[model samples]
Target: MNPVAIRDSYDVAIIGAGPAGLAAATLCAKGGLSTVLFDEQASVGGQIFRAIEETPVTDKRVLGASYWRGMDLTRAFRSSGAQYVPEATVWSLTPEREIGVSLHGGSVLTAARRVVICTGALERPFPIPGWTLPGVMSAGAAQILLKSAGLLPAGRTVLAGCGPLLWLIAWQYLNAGAQLSAILDTTPAGNRARALPHLLPFLFSGYFRDGMKLLRAVKREAPVIADITSLRAIGDDRVTHVEYRRGNGAAQRLAVDNLFLHQGVAPNVNLPMAVGIKHRWSDEQLCWVPVLDAYGNASIDGIAIAGDGAGIAGAEAAEWRGRLAAMAAARALGRSVPDPEETHVRDELARCLRGRPFLDALYRPARIFRQPSGDTVVCRCEETTASQIIDAIALGCPGPNQMKVFLRCGMGPCQGRLCGLTVTELIAEHRGLSPQEVGYYRLRPPVKPITVGELAALPKTDAALYAVTRM
Candidate 1:
């Protein structure tokens, strides 16, 4: 099959149809650029703005007015004239900016153009004893299961972790008819005390209303505990109990059938890293965000990153960033637009992002001192022990990538999505590089696995043509 014959190029290809990607696509399309938005899920909203086929019983109470705004964004994307392809998994992104998307019918789409990656984020998992148990799941995953599938884990489940997500998921479970055993938050109360000054602006603006709603939900459902020290799920096939230490160093155990854990989120940088975009370690966010200008132009000439994928801002910031990126891309393509409107949008987003007190406080993983137990595997693939990693550090491995070569820490089915950040931190602590300097390891394409038939069908010569053409 000739790749060119099957491929359709667009002026802009947005890889993710979430709040950010959808916003980018809508803005670009409305600006008169032929745009296409691709996503792996069978819907436009990304994880945060999840699509619900059935109106959730908890929608009115749980999501409130803010969620309706997200739905409006989705509707805008649908009507913006941009091609929205759901269930399209983008397997590889070449540095040259040719996007390889696998569609539903085994048909492949090679979209060539300026690409915007709004690939959101995954929840960071804490490696603890019995975490691999069946009933143990990320708080985000539990929320998705409840909101999207109308299902929750069996029996009473403890929602444990730090950050706003903990409260958010607890509310979801409570509304889903699942018993909330407790809300065990690991964030120190003093952290909130210190953040009060920064949070004042949001408070005055009524942005704190969201936090109040979450707190109200927590108060209504279960007891909320702060400064939890440790969590250990206990059971063979499923979680039966969770043992945790309080701030005073007293150990307590809660017997529950399920546990929801969330440390935080890391930028979903696998594909962006694979494409060789310049990344900077953000101390504030404690993650690698693609380095981009105010307009969202990344290090790559025609590639851009917006929203949480660039850094961990919520849906509002993402929407603004997406619009800014689309505007920049349009300007780069020699299109005209109102300069003052773009400037105002950028300034307002910057202010909103800066005003969020929780952004920095919640960006890093909950516990820095907590290391995976020796018996608990560090690298799931080779089953490397945490002790082994410590030993390698003592012998002076350069970084986690080197440790990966020795122990196969990152060469797993999930492709280091589960353990990469932890390994990098461990390596940085050992080698004396700042966590920022330690850096995320490089990713190579095809980022996700692909079949041989798809590879065989690639046009032999069009690689060069696709490389040169910018839709």
Candidate 2:
């Protein structure tokens, strides 16, 4: 995990140290390929298993046995012969397999015969009134704080929005003795009715027991306000109160210092899309997913995407997809790989994904939550509001790229990671088109913000060279 000793070239370069990236690296290394695994985190566990190796939470039961499962994966990744470089911020991947990365205040250019991007998932954009408030943060953020630093909300905390992660965090906070004010569930009642038919399929699938157990645990500990509406955080300098109306009830306000929001996650597509990979809108997940083959191969020949970055299929599926992608990459690189084991893994992956359609239908966020109305801030980085986006659309802005030109929705410090989905959905809704028809922002390097000093510090030997090929 040394940044200084990293080579400038490899047979395969995997971007990210999440479950998928780790699994892919392990397989490639086992095949005797010169592989390098890069990640921005100091450790290999992705968000799903963050801080598993070095968490202060001694009792693994506090976080559940599923959370502890990542330890086994990380331990295997460490023993793999692939060169693991932690704290490496990879900004771009060229079609020709050049990777631009920054680490330790310096830049490096690396090349590979095959590049696997497993950047994982980001919390789906959940824009609402007062979402930009100081105390307002994502539920995933709260979990990361808990995992990395054993930090909990100081005062009364309110969990808002929907998804299993919300329930998991609520249970974790309860276990950690944090004072949780309430749980505001935004999942519409109709979602459950629509998802009823798929329930039987899920019962026999992989996630049924665990999913039911998580729900029961949260329901036992927290007071859940279902079918919530008019959710708005109220405060001056910070979040002091959270207001919401349940079902047809009048607006109710609760004194809360922390508001943790969750509405599920979307694939982290900035890296793959930057390389001109074709993507399709997923109706089930209601987000953009890269158009990848069975083994996670992108439209481009030399690059492959795995994990939640390709699609949201959870950690176990990501590991399988990663191994499959590595096998594909190894074959492409003229290495012999086992076909039977790959077939078995693919079957297991399909089984893991059997319940996803049900989960997606059952947990789809409300329309208002997905695409907010009025003056709600849609783009946090630029402080762009939904009203501004509408104004742009009215002015003949056909897509998100033009909205970016007219309103700067995706041009900020965090790039488009924070607001891209909301912007896309907003424009699509206004234009009477699907999100894919409206199209997403055409990303460019450097994907992660980099300083000129870092660019100057790059080794002078490796120069930029990429052959342009249309896919």
Strongest candidate by TM-score: 2
Expressed as tens digits, the lDDT of each residue in 1-471 for candidate 2 is 233776768999999888899889989988888999999999778888888888988777678877888888888888978898888999878889889888877788889999999999999988989998999999999999998888989988899999878988988888787777799999998999999988877787778998888888788888888989669988888989999998889999999989999999999988898898999999789889999998899999889999999999888899999999999989988895564397799888988888888888899989889888788998888999988888889989998888888988889988888888888888889889988788888898889999988776665543332222222
> How does model 2 fare in lDDT?
0.88
Query: Which residue ranges in model 2 land beyond 4 Å of their true spot?
Result: 1-3, 337-340, 459-471
- Please report, as a residue range, the 10-residue window in candidate 1 with the lowest summed lDDT: 362-371
Q: Write the residue-wise lDDT of candidate 1 on 1-471 in tens digits.
A: 322233467788899877889889998888888888888987667887776434454556555565557778887887888887777778888767788877653546466568899998777657877777888888888877765676767777788877667777777667656778788887765666566666666665445777787778678769887778777888877888998988768788889887888877778988898889998877666667888988888898899998789888777888898998889888888775554397788776876676565545642445442356466666666667677887888887777688877778888767777777777777777777877777766678777777778876766566666776743
lDDT (C-alpha, whole model) for all candidates: 0.76, 0.88
